[model samples]
Target: MRLTGPAGLATRAVLAAAISGMVLAGSFAIVAVMAVAGGMILSAYGSDLLGFVRITPPQMFWPIVWLLCALGATGLFVRAIVRIIRTERAAFLERTTPLSETTMAETSYIDSSAERLARQVGIATPTVRIDSTATPLAYTTYRPDTSIINADRDETPVIVLSTGLIETLSQSELSAVLAHEIGHIANDDLRLISVLLMPLIAAETLTEDEGRTSNVFELCGHHLSFIALIGVGIFSRGRELAADRAAAVMTGEPAALAGALETLDESATPKPTADLRDHARSTNAINVLPTLGPANSGTGPRSTHPSLETRLEQLRSLARG
Candidate 1:
């Protein structure tokens, strides 16, 4: 799918929060452990130097308190990392499901269309897959196949379009949508986005493991790793908008892309109030919209794409020229 501005921003924000949470947990652990260690050292040696190496009540009480707090923070961090993994896994599963029963016939039609378009555009044909969800969406995926790899040939990219999206748009509009995704491939935007976000993913995984460790030193390290993840979230939204623009240019039919946006807007289902509230809390963002916005308007901190109205406006503007 075209990474709309809001979607990119949301992704970056999630990465950032993961990083921040990890860093905070790590810092708390380190400080707590150091305090505990210092207390123990003083209790062990202070009496010897002063000829009264006796364990005092206050000294013993404070070390235990510090250790307890450190353990609690570590638990909290572990929980947060587990939460991130579950959410990420769900999203990945949704994207990678094999196009089997969802829309076999519709997928075949689109795959045919994509091959035609590929030939027309003078690019190698891409294998197309369909996702059955009614939510209008499309995206391109590329992987280097070792079996097919040759020193003289470039690895091929794969394209996927949702059957719901194909049914929603006209033939011309579908072509425009395909072109937009193709633009991503042409610009190597997918690889770029993946590479840019890899650090955040790694940090997230690290925090997940380290946060679980009981050692105060390891727990402290988990919190320190999240700063980079937060940085990833802040910038992701802008990149999505850029990709949309790239798609429009590649298709040379801004109105078709605009129409596609309108179709997605209509297809979106309403989210329940409880779900919206839950999302807000989980994401730690204020004024987040319940639905994905169109290309141009209604963007918020948590939105993954721009509003439909805004996207349509840009498309119409381009079409007029």
Candidate 2:
């Protein structure tokens, strides 16, 4: 079946859920085994406690301990991973200080155009920032309002455009890109993506140290990371398509988006000798355009974004309509 409509989305959602469940179950199994093993060690040593402090409970309490431990570990993992990502983003912005909001604010033309487009998209004019990188890139992020202490307010979305993108794309193409990002914000995709990343983040923590897997529990946890990545990829691809459709409708310029994608595809084509593997991977993971260069040819299956050809074809269909 050609799964690309509501049915396809449902199927992908189901697959993501199944994969997530498998990963969680595997993780719980590991925790249970470790809890049991620790209990056995304590019992063998005739110790009525754990770590020589907390009193060890009966066999029935081991399961409760495992659940609590797993929950605690998962919570910490999510917090740590989110913090790390935030730290890295902050560091990048700091290092590229010349491209900050104050710097871009001086560019009245871009600011005006973005404001106009933001109105057309039916959302607040997002704070616009520029990145000094030569590689063409654009993305959006949402930071919830922190002013009211605990107000149930919407997030303040920010749209970031790279220097290369500003210099390369035509005005219409640029507008199309911004529209796509606005679509992401309007759909509350950032929150959805953050929630989806929890399982993957936990899996990533478990697999961080390759040599740390000393037992079956660790091994299973490590393997579950790959499964979580698969689920992540599935949902990400669908989200990208949804964003594309939103952009096309909002901009009434599907062809412009296609043109922008074509240009980015050319820029992303890796040089034979350039070590852009990591950059390409990151770009494909988050950027609006998939860097379909020579360095990433074999990523057809694992890529977070759909193929350039696929995206272009979809846009072309939109254009025809």
lDDT: which candidate is best?
Answer: 2
lDDT of 2 by residue, 47-114 (tens): 44464786665776655654665566656554665664454345334423323344443467667766
For model 2, the superposed segments whose C-alpha errors exceed 4 Å read 1-7, 46-106, 143-153, 205-222, 271-283, 291-301
Model 1 C-alpha lDDT per residue in residues 13-85, reported as the tens digit of each score: 4565565455555555555576666666765565565556454555466557657666665566556554554
Error of 1 at 310 (Å): 3.0
Measured by TM-score, the strongest candidate is 2
Model 1, position 239, has a per-residue lDDT of 46
- Report the poorest 10 consecutive residues by lDDT, candidate 2: 144-153
Q: RMSD of candidate 2 to the true fold? A: 5.7
- After aligning candidate 2 to the native by TM-score, how far in Å is the CA of 162 from where it should be? 1.9
